[model samples]
Target: LGFALTCQYLAARCAFGYGTDLRAAVFRHIQTLSQTELDKLGSSTLINRITNDVTASQSGVNMFIRLASRAPFLVVGAIVMALLIDWQLSLIFLIIAPIVGFLLYFVMHRTIPMYGANQKRLDRIARRTGENLDGVRVIRAFARQKQEDERFAEDCAELERSMLAAGRISAVLNPLTFLILNLGIVAVLWFGGGHVDTGRLSQGDLTAFANYMTQILLAMVQLANLIQILTKAQASSLRIAEVLETKSSMQDGTETPDTASEEAICFEHVTFGYPGAGDPALEDISFTLQKGQTLGLIGGTGSGKSTLAALITRSYDPTEGNVRVFGKDVRSYKGTALHRCIGTVPQKAVLFTGTIAENLRWADEHADEQTIREALETAQAAEFVDAMQYGLETHLVQGGRNLSGGQKQRLTIARALAGKPAMLILDDSMSALDYATDAALRKALAERQGMTTVVISQRATSLMHADLILVLEDGRCVGQGTHSELLETCEVYREIYEASAK
Candidate 1:
């Protein structure tokens, strides 16, 4: 019993240790993967690869350790004991063992492919579950609850059918093995009884021989169970390997960027297309921003404005030319140096489930209350934040679901400001705010002239005050100049300005 406890402890230690390490590694690798890779591999599949696959592998390790010694010992020991009891009765072991081996081989081989198919279907079930949970509000708002329920039911039904099919195949292994072994036991009694009558085998020896045969049968059954576990583990391992085997399409540079120079950002003849895209997203895009100036990107939907910003951030390297920061290629900037210099507010305001202070700390871990308050004030978020019962300690629900859209946007901006980055990127983040609030936020940013700013928006008012503005249309910059200059020379800019004035 003590030995068994020790064995269990060691097995648990190894399984959990490997699982933790593998999970961390997978999470880190997923971070390295580009958005393109994320698009190709959906969120649910990746979640399964990280969580479920690791669990299966751990279970496999536990099963192996538990059965590795015990199963073989029982089988071999039983054969030896049977031989000692009666040499003639031991022949039944030799005759029956080969047939059991053949059965195990046939079932195990057929079960592997089934397990693989079931795992794939399980991924679909996970995907549907995730979608239902995340989009619950949207479904309710659209009055599609019944339809969504039916869709989810369909997903579940298909998964259940596949699992049942695989399970039914596995079910056959036990009854068939037990039947063969019981028949062998019956044969042993008849043959051993004859020996006993002839005075060649005693009744006691016959009984011992039958018991040994039962041990061998039980051991083989356990081994068959191990085969089932191994099949599932093999499927899970292959899925995990697919993720580990993928190389990140984006690579980081070794060089650290110098941020003291006058030129904060530059793009020269840059053009890029996403993988498998028919046309380039950005065609020969070129721009520059001085260290203390504001650059605005104004474009219609699908005008490639966001693509240009991604180039500066080095989210993807340009297929044609160079994107640089501080007189060096953007690709040459090391991660810390690049991210430290840039604070980006994405189009979507995503907030984790944590206290307001906790979420703010993501931008700068060491930021104090005074710094955080100042950022909130600048983003015009101080009023509502202080109004909360717990103030900065107020807990935010996932994605800031408790707050209005405008409030969430302000908090997102404050989070970015807390970092005090050299370059601040506000990517159409103020759309939810009122005009008065928007104006106030812009005024606050204008006061901070030392930090380079890039504002991308469709509203001309958002970019009218910018030091330099670029008008994008169909992936090309048709105009580039100050607002007044573009109004006079560029027809596209004049038309946009004219329309906005209405």
Candidate 2:
């Protein structure tokens, strides 16, 4: 009880720290996540780690300290106390102890790998379910609900099968253990009868020996239980180790930037690939966007548009080239320094469960209400936010569920602008809004002083206003010029413009 209480107290404190640190780490990880990685694991498994996996690990640790630690002490002490009663009967314990050890050894070895597979299968199920739920609206819209349901059910079945396999192994061990223990007790009685008949052993001594035999068997049971706990823990440890040991594919070079760029963003023959991918996502990409200039990017899906944004912010360093910002290579700026300078609104607008003000503060914690209001106005969000009951303090549910798609998109843009970053990136963020809203937002951004902007979009109206536009296809820069120049000179650019106009 004392140990249990102590563990409960420590668990409460550890839980708070675990929650805070893991939340921050996961958030940072999401920011740096590439599309390839996201596609590989999906959101649900990530969510489970942030919730279920961590919970399991903490529970396991708590059990290890509370139950596993004390049980062994009790078991060992009981065994030693038993040995002092009768040495001849203690010889019976020595025989069965090794047998129990061998049994536990077999169980542990078999169950450890099974438990590991079970947990991974659980992660897969979580990922599938999460993907289905998040995209339920779209699934229904496309009449693919049945298809998604089937996929989720398949994952669930696989998880169940894996878990049952482990359970079956664990379930068999106990009965086998009881049988072995009973046999040992019968042998003790058979041997002790002759001693008692010849008056070689006292009646009390035989009774004590019988009781001690029970203790020895009980100790074996404890050892078996400890092995089971360790099996589960071993599996969990490996999963956590996978995440902790993963080296970020992007790392800074020892070569310092001897010189800096005057431009806010510069890509020098930049090349990058998804980790372990065969081909580069962005190859031989080069660009220079000075402070206060708007550089627009246009391309088909998979044209490395967002990859370029990631490179600019140093989410991933170019595999074969340099990405320079603010007269220094971005690698030179670590942690807050690099992040503070660049603000990004991704293609999918993301929001947390907080007030509008709180979400904006994510970009700039020191930003005042006035700064937030200005950003909202710039993104065309202030009018709607003002009409709400709480305005800046208006509560936002997770993923902005309370708001329209366009509202969420505008809120993301507002978040980017709130930081007043030297460089702002909108990665197809305006797709949800009407052309009117998109145009107004762009115009407002244009009016902002000394803010360099990058826009990745498919819309002609969006990129038409840019100082320069780069057209991309198949990971190569096929066109680079003003809107008119691209339309006249680049066939791909003209085809895109004509298609959008249609």
Scored by TM-score, the top model is: 1
Give the poorly placed runs of model 1, Cα more than 4 Å off.
Answer: 84-95, 190-200
Taking all chains together, each candidate's TM-score versus the true structure is 0.92, 0.90
In candidate 2, what are the lDDT values of residues 1-502, reduced to their tens digit? 8876876677567655664676567656665554445656666666666565656565556555555555667667766776676567668777887887788888888988888787778877776777778888888899997788788788788888888888888887778788899899898888888789888777887887777677767766766666677678777766665555444554433443222335777888988888778888999988888778899999999999998888887766678888888767788766456667778999899999999899999988999988998999999999999999988889999899999999999999999889877778999999999988888999999999788889999987689878889898878899898999998899988988888878
Could you tell me the TM-score of candidate 2?
0.90
lDDT of 2 at 483: 92
Lowest lDDT block of 10, candidate 1: 111-120
> Which pairs of residues collide in candidate 2?
260-327, 261-327
Task: Estimate, for each residue in 1-502, the C-alpha lDDT of model 1 and write its tens digit.
Answer: 9977888888889889988998999999888887778878888889988888889987988888888768898888889888888888899888888998898888778877777777777788888888878888898999999998898788788878888888988898888989999999999999999999999988888888888888988988888888788878878888888888888677778887677788988889988998889999999988888897999998889999888888778777889988888788888777667987888999989999999999988889999999999899999999999998999999999889999999999999999999998888888999999889999999999898588899988778888899999999989999999999998989998888888768
Give the distance in Å from residue 54's predicted Cα in candidate 2 to where it truly belongs: 3.4
| Deviation (Å) of 33 in candidate 1 | 2.7
